[model samples]
Target: MDSFEQLIGKNINEVDLNESKTFFIALLEYDTKHCGKRYPSSKYKLADMDYYDLISFSQLFKKEAILIVWYNMDIITDLEIYYLSNDFDILFNDYYIIKKAIDNGLAHKLTEGDTKYLGASRLNEKVPQPHSDILANKREFVLKKKYLQKIIDEISFSCK
Candidate 1:
């Protein structure tokens, strides 16, 4: 198993997570075509469930995990690893907003701009949402593209 896969399900320390983040970042090829640009296309939507697992792990363990941002089927344009000041409260708040939206049958209206950090992005499937009979497009929580771009700009600037 890879070092990252090994860290899964284990109580990872900050240092170890940071090491993994750094290694993952190093492997990414800066996407000049998409990074710092407007949203590419729906085709770029993240289709990997493993990333959702990592997001869940980050919230449950209060540790950072690398989230690769795919701009399309073939290109991964950016990555994000956030460390919130009050991780639990902020995460809970974002969760609350998303849940409420879904419960109100407004899942179709949920957009990347709804929450501060986390967004309920559309998935490829349509599914029944909780507390509502509407067959809303399945959604997954993701780091907002704008937020990821900001992080990318920061990282790029720092590297200069």
Candidate 2:
């Protein structure tokens, strides 16, 4: 699969792109609901995005059918895709990480013990560890509450 940038540029048609004001407006509503901020759009600055910005971008990218997989030390670390059936607006889909890894060639399932699936978005942490409360034993991927809350808090604080 192509990168988010490549996917959006290649997959979204010219007519859709031109008529996409509504799509972007819907995306804004989606972002506000999910990440508490409107996405910033500029072709030049994609490479410099921060975490929350990337979260915002991911929603729009997923809406355009882009699949984002963030890997950490060969674990199927983070997966982001929109649930289009529920709403025209975007929503996150959590996956059975172990199954996803095995299916996607990221890792093999272990018979016992916790399988660590670290977050690739550890912006400042010195070491990567379990970043979510969702049991690793369940083999599912979820963003950690504290990490997500911190981003939301920063968005709240900065906009104040």
- Give the top-scoring candidate (TM-score): 1
Model 1 Cα lDDT, one tens digit per residue, 48-136: 22221323434432434454433333344456554434354665677678766765667767776777656677777876655556667
Instruction: Estimate, for each residue in 65-90, the C-alpha lDDT of model 2 and write its tens digit.
Output: 32233322223333444223342221
Give all candidates' CA lDDT scores.
Answer: 0.48, 0.28
- Predict model 1's lDDT versus the native: 0.48
Determine which window of 10 residues in candidate 1 has minimal summed lDDT: 43-52
- Clashing pairs for predicted structure model 1, backbone only: 44-71, 44-72
Distance from true position, residue 58, model 1, in Å? 7.0
Which residue pairs of candidate 2 clash? 97-139
Q: What is the C-alpha RMSD of each candidate to the true structure, in Å?
A: 9.2, 18.3
